[model samples]
Target: MSGARHREEDLLRGISASAGMAIGPLRRYELPLPRVAETAADPAAERQALAAALETVAATLESARHSADAQGQQEEAEIFDAHLAWLEDPALREAAEHHIAAGSSAGQGWYAALQAEIERLRQSESALLAARVDDLRDLQRRVMAPLAADAGAAEAADDDLDGAILIAREMTPSQFVAVAGRIQGLCLAAGGATSHLAILARARGVPCVMGLGEALLSLTAERAVLDATHGVLESAPDAERLAALVAERERRQAQARSAAEQACAAVITRDGRQVQVAANVGSAAEAQAAARAGADGVGLLRSEFLFLGRAAAPTREVQRREYAAALAALDGKPVIVRLLDIGADKQLDYLSLPAAPNPALGERGIRLWQTFPELFETQLDALLLAGNEAPVADAATPLQLMLPMVSDVGELRWVRQRLAARAAELGITRLPALGVMIEVPSAALCAVSLAREADFFSIGTNDLTQYVLAMDREVAGLAAHCDVLHPGVLRLIQATLEGARGRCPVGVCGAAAGDPLAAALLVAMGVDELSLEPAGIAALKAWLRELDAAALAARVPELLALDDGAAVRAVLAAWLDASAPRGFGVMSERRGHTHNKQ
Candidate 1:
């Protein structure tokens, strides 16, 4: 482990949470834990004390959630939602009750319960589950401090962290939120790449590296070079390396400024073919960010954000408000909102779905909607109501509705009939365009038939690649195999376009769309639109402006003939190295390294 820590010699190794470089003074910021007694004198009083502490924590989390929502910080609000859910979990309560009944104090019982839960999660095979251990520890501290009457752990410090690289054993989401903007970068001794801290760091464009273990905690150097792009921390850099890093930092800043300046410009290939660059957002905040980043439109509005991680489904009025807020953020830009695509990996405790051997291949998305038509109708009504509220300045770009997991034309027709019925019921005359998401092999194979009924087609490459390769996306150790750049997935994409036959615009909204290398190949294949996350829009557009799509088109036949993903990636890398413009060095080096919170 020590050898791995210094893999490159004199540099501490870790996983990159965000891509960037930062050279600054190192500052250690630790959140102390409250000590607790092992046993209690009164069991009844201990139980009551535990109950009160739970209520306090829940109320605090709820307040934080509302504050985040009011501030248009959707991801920050969702982090609180997970904490609140844990507070309401029956298993967690039972675990604490058992400990209290065994003659333990409220703080001790809660601490033990959370520690056990954290250990269990750490033993899980899923990285997502393991990454949640910090959250559980956070809850333990929150509840324990209240029971122990210790206010020190929860108080905010006034320490100045400006332009300093923060070092910690682990960080909670709330802690990260408080110091996100003040810090230059982050280095965690124990944390996962998928942790909420990492997500916040990436979103804020803060250079971050995690999972360095005790080696990071042993660092006593006052200054360090944090190269998050390569996931290495250098405590002492020579004069020449320091100078090079400074120049590199200036170059990156200049590149970012240039990209932002050209974000709103049309992405026309050198050969004069226009390609739409849109954003895939989940909330009004994300949509607004996309618009500000110069996205042409919202290509995929993940409506599930409004429904998931809740005690109950959102009301029609609530749904209407959320949708309208997102639409208003886009102003006149086109927005495609996907219907409720839940069940499977995303489950609601209130809705007890039937158990399946493999949830990924089970009844999900449109299939689940079919089982609960009332839920479907409620969302449809809300969307139509929002659409009827106010007219956009650009009438041509209306709110469009998309259906997910449609395997054939029948599903498209079924959704269209339902959409029309709901619109008519609400006295709405102008129906939004209806589209189908090409995710399943059957749907891609039958794109021609479905295209006749649907208004547009969006390829969800994330799902399509997993299905095509017969790999479960959520399973550990399959990320390399589940890559969308595989020749098999590319072939399916080509087939989908061929089936569409220019009857409707074909857009790629999956994770691959955000990748520059994949984006170039997508353009080469004649894809009409590329929709990715908001932060990536500027860089992607800047890169796309340098390519000649017609010239790329001539190489498609050869690219499709490649045997595997590695081969395709090698070809794209060589092409980028030879053809990318001089000013796009950052963009070229960043290709094929897209990191998204899946």
Candidate 2:
């Protein structure tokens, strides 16, 4: 007899995360646990079972680590490493043994012990350790929940659910590692898009739907199609729907690959103006990938990754090694490293500060630097050392020094004086050009004064918009005013650029720079350079290559002349609508042809 044919169908969905389609097999995983009887008599055997269970968990973590490493998922591998450590901990094993001796079955004993530890940790005063302990306990429950179910079943169930929808109340990092490649799309009963699970999904290029409620329970194995982009769960999809979905997925994948290729190409404007494209990276692996992706340099190197979650402050030597590795990977490209910008949002017990009612407006960025001079000095010393030992390049790589959250001229002078003293102490001769981030409204207003003391200006539009409009981007109710295109925010940017007065170069390294229309508007306002996320490089470049900045510049004064925000936005929108279609479309459509012949 011939094997049954599998029919494909088309599925239409929403774009929940704002990216394009990604079609892969559905990979699913359920948290499993070992079976347990109500009564227990064999204490020695129970101990042995616990040890064996630990061994199994360790093996599972190792396998996951290896698989993630092979796939170039370093962050996933790190998650597994944490699981491995938890499984091997003597304290955790001892707790399980004690529970077994108290007359519980093996699986029950393990679950009980884990729950007790979790409760204790959650109640602890140390928020950092409490968070970690909660995470570990959550993983234990997820990893063992399914195994426990199978123990009660008549036969062993399959661990691998190839390309299946993962329907779960929640997912822990370790559970995510255990079923890494087996899941196609994830549907959680509850979670925010920025939650750890969603973050992991985005990083791994997996489709996910969070806060799906109890609708996930109705989904059977390999019988339902989940359109994550649109939040639709189609039970028993027809052939036509499946076929359409598959085709759409393929098209999306092709578009992403094409975009990536284009991002690696040079960024040139319609008038032949060239702007360097770079990536914002946080780790060694990311730095290397950014380099491979044809990023001109590292625009923002967030150093918090090294400091956060550490039991003690990372030694100067360790900090140096991390920075040095990133510099080496850039191969002499300028890497703008920002000092630690922690606050109530990211509180460290070691660097204790009173709990604030509003952290965003409280001690953060340069404020923290002023409060904790020693910590700031250590980081400054390490960064300067990294710059001194950085490899020589064919061209002079402008290793610009950037200070975050400087609101006035005094902050600039304070940072420079400290840098001078530190340099003299270290016996350094030359220093990299110093720059200040224009993120505060006051800084924007006082740009000309601040610019006199700095070598360059990089506008952080994210915070600038938030501060200017007095609107929180996270709050959906205020999203209308939170836009970067708001007249007030645009005026601030214009003023800052005008204040520079061609003395020092000005660039924008923010989400606004990545948007095609926003980039055009900024260029019109005379921004010298634009830095965006690596993924947005191609689309932004395509728009830039079609825009005549001189023409845009001519129109910008008129656009800004209007005092009404709505009027200004309308004029700019109308101008773009009339000019962009033919200009941008034709240029992007012909880019491949021109580049191939060259």
TM-score winner: 1
- Model 1 lDDT on a 0 to 1 scale: 0.81
Candidate 1 per-residue lDDT, tens place, 459-528, comes to 9987898899998654333544567888899988998999887688899998788777889889888799
TM-score of 2: 0.74
- How many steric clashes does model 2 contain? 36
Q: Which digits, one per residue and each the tens of the lDDT, describe model 2 over residues 405-523?
A: 88998988988999888978999756767888898899999999988888888888877887898865443234334567767888899889989976787888776665555677787
Listed per model in order, the count of residue pairs whose N, CA or C atoms clash below 3 Å is: 0, 36
Q: TM-score for all predictions?
A: 0.87, 0.74
Q: Candidate 2's C-alpha lDDT?
A: 0.65
Q: Give the worst 10-residue stretch by lDDT in candidate 1.
A: 1-10
Q: Measured by TM-score, how close is model 1 to the native structure?
A: 0.87
Q: Which residue pairs in candidate 1 have backbone atoms (N, alpha carbon, C) closer than 3 angstroms, thus clashing?
A: none
